[model samples]
Target: MKLHPTSDFRGLPPAEDALVRYLCAHAEALLNAAALLGDRPAVRRTARLFEELAETRQPLTRRQHAGIRDLHRLLSLEGVDDPDSLEAACFAEIDPASPVVEEICLLTDGLASRLAALRQAEGQPFGMDLSAAA
Candidate 1:
């Protein structure tokens, strides 16, 4: 799959825009991984989530924002000790010589880095508690 550049999220607050972009990119990566895994159901579900996020301008609640962070962490293949998880399994099947997998990995890494930078600039700690707002 060809990786597209991030979309310009106009008419959204900076934070909301960042969150939406992050979710969209994350979902895109999941969709690619699902394709590689031949999991049609995952592809459909992730595609729906990506479309919903791309079209919505609604502000994310604290919990939803935290969910993004958690999901990003779950999808990250770096430093994970679990061998049976989806991320690990997908990564295990990836060929180091394959450009598609490499592109997906790079895109995912870039998105995660961008999200971390956005959180830092907003004075938010990584994985900050959202329950406090409940």
Candidate 2:
């Protein structure tokens, strides 16, 4: 079911909610990049997913989140390993007159880093802290 956009942020504390919105903005940035360079079928498909999510105001399911991660991985595989290569690779075949490619690459890399940190932070197994027991 689709969630209200506000509902998506409802239970989160202010900081966490802001993080969610920040991440959503990053996803939108990725979507913009996908639109600009989505000549490939896979990239086009991923863009469609991002579009749908944006329109529906839905929280990502595990599968959808995985798809975002996969898209980021694919972009990295496209030789975006560093700033110089990212500029060169992401701007391939584009007019040098347009200046957004570098920004897109920076956004992509930033999103990937944030996503990685979120994943790592969430990866810890759940358990009670019993160290205070006496």
Candidate 3:
């Protein structure tokens, strides 16, 4: 499937809006893997994302579930018939970047950086081109 169909979310500022979109992408991907391959590994990853979202204590709705299903259907076209092999290959592809724990650290870093920027913007004076920096 198309990993990112468009960067439309760029119109949003980098904070809660942007970070939530990015995390949703990650969560959707994991759920997609589970739907396509019946992969428990993907389910676990998706559950982690769910937990993170839950930390905010926001209520989940039907749309999110639909999003996961749609992504799974689209990505499953290649016929990832064997989940074990799929997970193994996925891990192998990322192994060179570091172990699993460090990989998660990097992902969390991206989310935190975007979220922090948004929070900073909230405290900044509004309606100005403060994004200008040297």
How many residue pairs clash (N, CA or C atoms closer than 3 angstroms) in each of the candidate models, in the order given?
0, 0, 1
Q: lDDT per residue, candidate 1, 1-134, as tens digits?
A: 22233665676667567657665655656667555543454466555556555555555555555554444554465424566655566556778798876766766676577666666656779665433321
lDDT, candidate 3, 1-134, per-residue tens? 23332334443434544555665567564454453333565566456545544343232233433333333332332233455566444544444455543535555456445435653666744322223311
Ranking by lDDT: 1, 2, 3
**Candidate 3: misplaced stretches above 4 Å?**
1-5, 14-98, 124-134
- lDDT for model 1 comes to 0.57
lDDT (tens digit, per residue) of candidate 2 on 1-134: 22223435554434334434554666546656665554455456666555544443334455555665656655554544455653345546566566665766686676565554554455522232212211
Which of 1 and 2 is the better model by lDDT?
A: 1
Better of 1 and 2 by TM-score: 1
Off by over 4 Å in 2: 1-7, 11-20, 26-28, 40-44, 51-60, 77-91, 95-98, 124-134
CA lDDT, candidate 2, residue 15: 34
Q: Give the worst 10-residue stretch by lDDT in candidate 2.
A: 125-134
lDDT of each: 0.57, 0.51, 0.45
TM-score of each: 0.60, 0.52, 0.33
**TM-score between model 1 and native:** 0.60
Question: Best-fitting candidate, measured by TM-score?
Answer: 1
